[model samples]
Each structure stands twice: as structure tokens, then as C-alpha cells.
Target: MNGVSEVFSTILLTSIFLALVFMLLPFSYYTIMGSVAKTEYEYVKHGFYSIATYFPMIATGGEYSIDFPSQYTSRGYIETGRIDIYLNSSSQPTLSFPCMALTQGASVGGAPRGLLYGVDTYIVNDSRMIPRIYEYRDGNGLMIMTLDTCRLLLDVNIVPTGNYSGYYYVLTYYNLTISFRGSGSLRIEPVRMYTVYSNIGGNLWNITIVVSDYILGKSFSYSVIDLVKMGFGKEYAGIPFSLTIVVEELVVEV
Candidate 1:
């Protein structure tokens, strides 16, 4: 009878142990998955920050590359993403391009948040009444004057002349948007850049910078006169002038 009692006690203990493991299984799995997702999110965010911080360099038609992990978690995968550039206080974007990012499996902390970078405003003072047409590359188009911290690309067929001219200074206002996605690694480069000029008023002009790529198929615009007020004249010490709106699409390869 004692041997039978001992056998029963061993069976009961084994049952309890198995039940405890089953109860903890889900908690352990979720905890591990959450940690993994967070780490993946951080990696993507860092890649975006690097692109934003060195955007000027990349804008000069250079290649920027980053490693994009295929999966955030066992179930989460990357989808389409994009980057947008807003100049000044305008509600619309002056420049935009396609990017990639994770878009599924919300149970594992959802997708990463988008990134925003504020660009400093600089006054570009050109002594000539007609803005100097910088050097034109063999095939790259016109390379505009480089600011204190950034370079601008503009393609102009009609250069301002006569009364519509004076010492001009352009106020630089810009911002950036970055998103992510894909498997293995990715390379981003500017495929094309061009600008169109329109005479909106006597002294005020509309400049549109258009960038195009495979994934981008939209256009957006905003006026500079609404953001900052200034006059144009050779008599004034440093008259603010010229509104530049940039629209761009880029090639991103995996």
C-alpha cells in the first residue's frame, strides 16, 4: 500500500510541473518577441537618422546605403515607405521620394515612428542683379550656388534681366521625412534633378525643383511669399528674394 501511495504522489508532482510550464509559455514567448521587435525598430531608426543628418551630401548625387533586415519579428515584415521635404511653414511638400518600412504585425509593438529633421534657414546674398548661373555639368544640368551648409540644384532656361533684377538674397527653409523597409541591404541615389522657373510677378518668381523616380508619381507645391516677407531692389541693403519649391523622386535598390 505504501509503494502505491508513493507512485501516486510522484504522478501528482509531475502533473503540477507540466501545468506550470504550460502557463508560462506564452508569457516567455511574448517577452522575447517584444524585445526583438524593439531592437529592430531602433536599427531602422538609426539608419534614417544617418540619412537625414547627411542629406546634403546625398543630395549632391551620391549613393547612400543601409542594411534593412527582412523581418522585424517572426510575423512582422517590411512594406513600402517614403521621405518628404517641406520648405518653411508650407502645408505641402516641396520634395518627396520613395523609401521602405515595416508595416505588419502590430501585436509586436507595431511599426516604428516616422522621422522629422529641421533645416536651418540661411540668407543667400547674390551681388548680381541677375542671379549667377553656376557651372553647368556635361550631363548633370545646372549646379546652383552652394549655401553655407547646403547645395541647391536648379535648371533655369530664362534668367532674370533688366528692371526685374537687383541684389538678391534667398531664404533657405527646408525639412526632411524618412521611412524604411526591405530585406538584406538598400542603396539610395538621385537619378535626376531639374528646376522650372516661372515669372509670377514683377520681381517675384516661382521656382520648382522636380525629382522623379520609379515609385514616386505625385506632385506638391507651396509658395515662399506666404512664409516670409521681403522686398526686391538694388537700392535696399539686402532685399530678400526668390521662392524655390523642390519636388524629387529617387531610385532605391535592394
Candidate 2:
């Protein structure tokens, strides 16, 4: 009888231990996977910040590539995700063409995640109206885009108008779509730039930059004064004058 009782007690303890482990298995797996996903998200965010910081150094037709993580644990498998750029105009922006960065499968707890650069309003003169980038929404997900002073000047060339006393500014807008896929190298290049100008009033001209992304089938326009406020041109003190502006286009590939 004593030997049988001892055997029964051992069996009961073993059953309880296995049951506890079975119950905790799912919780443990999720905790570890969630941690891994968060780490991957941070890594990607840092990569984007670095790119935005040095984006201006890349010249027209120049390309920059970044490697993404091999696996996104949150998605329950390894796959490539995408990074999107959006014009963030929730409020007035102080930077020249401010943008935000949004990523797919990089969120925690269903909360929105993105990066915002060049937030200092004091960096440029205040403009009457700040131009906004065309908003692009991916389902119910948020989109983000960012542009810095250097990046803004990458395609802009300012020259002295020999015929006139004022300066001539050439602003280029690249209208292209970038599709970044999983764990692969993502490449970015200023493929093409187009410029358009219209005289709004006296010295104040409505310089519109129309950018199109064919892959997304959408296009939007914003003013050029956003550049002027960044010290792109001088404010004329005398009467409002006009100059003969020429529109130009250049095409390149990734």
C-alpha cells in the first residue's frame, strides 16, 4: 500500500508540472516574439533617421540603398515590408517641405509609429501659408514623410540672373514611386525633377511643384515659397518685378 501511494503522488506532481508548462507555453512564445518585433522596429527606425540626416548629400541621379531585417516576427513569418513617405501637415510646418516616415508591420499594440525630422520652426522665416504634400493612406494605417534643408537643396540651383538684378532659382521636384520589399535592399534615387511657375500677384509668385507617383496613381502640388523662406532667394524691396521663367525636366532610373 505504501509503495502504491508513493507512485500515485509522483504521478500527480508530474501531471501538474506538465499542465503548468502547457498553460505558459503560449504566453512565453508571445512575449519573446513581441520583444523581437520591437527590436526590429527600432532598428529600422534608426536606419531611416540616418538616411534622412544624409539624404541631401545624394545628388541628382544618385542612389542610396538600405538593408531591412530578414524577419518580421510579428507577422508570424519572414517577409519583406515597405516604407512610405507622407507629407505631414497636421499643423504648420517650419521646415521646407516637411514629411513623415511610416512603415508596415512595425507597430506595437496597434499604435501608430513614425519618425518626424526638422521640426524647428525658427530655422526658416515664417511663411503666410505652408504647402502640404499630398496625403497617401494605406488602409487605416498612418503615413509619414520627412525632408531636411540639405535634401531640399539637392536639386535646387540658385544663380544670378545676369539680365536682371534679382536671382533666378531653379527648383526640381522628383515625381516617382518607390516600392521597398521584404528583407531586400531598398534603393532611392532622384530619378526626375520638373518645375512649374505661375505669377500669383506682384512679387509673390505661385510656384507649384507637381509630383506624381504612378505606382500609387496619385499626384499633388505645393508652393515654392516654402523654399524662399529657407533663404533660397532675396526679397525685393522695390516694385514687384517678373522674370521669364523656363520649365525643365530630367529623367533617370534606379
Candidate 3:
């Protein structure tokens, strides 16, 4: 009986020791990887032209890919080059890889993609004054199709570990993640010279690109949709709202 008891105790001790070692192995591995991640700071170089860096948000659905805009490239446009990467997961894994680009300049209209966190106001569909009726207080029936045309006020770029501030709209809209195949041609250019404002100087929001040979014979048209206004609900819906838009149309525009 004593021999039997001694054998069982030896086996229990051995099992516990092995289990401890197994649990610790993974923790040590991740620690090593985290150390390597710190190097992300070593290469950050501030400039007028920057390749887009995407700190992906956890897909929450499935594996997907998004592109970075080339407006921040050398000359406010990148024909092609390296882009910062991040997965929309706790993985926080990052990569720098080569890519093609969609037009340039600050995002104005078209399919909403990538990290669109802070955007103030944008016109939905067209700013054209169409007639759509809304029953507001019975006799007070109103037309919503025509209101102060909420133009593309602004879409602040997302940065790594940086906080950007802008008006938050709880508007109902489409937020899209798209995939395209086959070579095609698309061009995005920003026209009209203008100035806007932020929390800082009222004169701070201005488009300062110097044009060599550009012309504005007369007027322009508005086709971009306002995702923020689309997301608007009863009084901004209790603050801290997200301006996530749906892809009413699925062609990516930057």
C-alpha cells in the first residue's frame, strides 16, 4: 500500500510541473514579439508627403484588405509605394508593403472605406435641390431634399496613437470595405480654392496646394454623399457617436 501511494504522488507532481511549463511558453513567445514591435517608432519621419499607415480595426466579421490614400505621398499623390499596415484585431500586428493608389488630396466623396472616424459634414448623393416630402407635425409637413447643403466639410486623417477631433454625427449611412480586380482607370482631383476652420484658428482650414496650370471656367457640381448626415438621429444619440457610413455605392473614393 505504501508503494502504491508513493507512485501516485510522483505522477501528480510530474504532471503539474509539465503543465506549468506549457502555459509559460506562449507568454514568453509573445513577450519576445512585443519587444520587436517597439521598433515601429524608430522609423517614423514627419513630412508633407507621407505614405498611408492603416492601424486596422478588428474586422469583427472576416478577413479583409483596405488601401491607404496616396495624397500624403511626395507631391500629395503616390503613383505607388510602401504603406503602413495594421490588422483590425488585438493582434496589433503591422506591416509595411508596396501598393497602388486612388486619386489624392483629402477625401471628399464616393464609397466610404478605410478608417473614417472623424468627419464633420458631407452632401449625400447630389447637392441638387430635389423635392422629397417629410411629414413633420402633420400640417407642418416639410421638404428634406432641400436644406442647407451639407457639403464635405472635412475628413481628418487617422494617425497612429494620435487623437483627431471633429464634429461627430450619428447619421445613418453606409461604411464600406471593398475589393476590386482587373486593371482599370480612375482619376480623383480636388478643385476650387477654399478655406475652412477647426478647433484651432478659424483660418486654419485652408487648401494650400499651389497649382501650376489649372482653370475654373465657372461652376462645379456636387455628387458626393454625406455619411454623417445619413447617420444623424434624434439629437446625436447620447454623444460619443460614431460616423460609420454604409457603401450605398461600392466604388472607393479618396
Screening candidate 2 with a backbone cut-off below 3 angstroms (N, C-alpha, C), the clashing residue pairs are 80-182, 86-144, 99-145, 99-146, 100-144, 100-145, 100-146, 101-144, 101-145
**What are the clashing pairs of model 1?**
81-99, 94-246, 100-180, 100-181, 101-180, 101-181, 211-247, 211-248, 211-249
Q: How well is each residue in 89-136 modelled by candidate 1, as lDDT tens digits?
A: 335655544432322222234322221322221122321111111111
lDDT by residue (tens digit), candidate 2, 73-101: 22111111111212223232222332222
Over 4 Å off, model 1: 73-107, 110-183, 200-248
The lDDT for every candidate, in the order shown, is: 0.39, 0.39, 0.26
- Better candidate number, 1 or 3, judged by lDDT: 1
Quote the lDDT for 19 in model 3: 97
- Taking all chains together, the TM-score of candidate 3 against the true structure is 0.20
- Tell how far residue 168 is off in model 3, in angstroms: 43
Best by TM-score: 2
Quote the lDDT for 48 in model 2.
54
TM-score of candidate 1 relative to the true fold: 0.51
Encode model 3's per-residue lDDT on 1-254: one tens digit a residue: 99999999999999999999999999997775544332221111111012112111111121223333222221122222222222222133133222222322221222323222222222333222111111111122211010011122223232233464444322111222223342232212212222221122222212121111111112222111222223343333222222322111112222
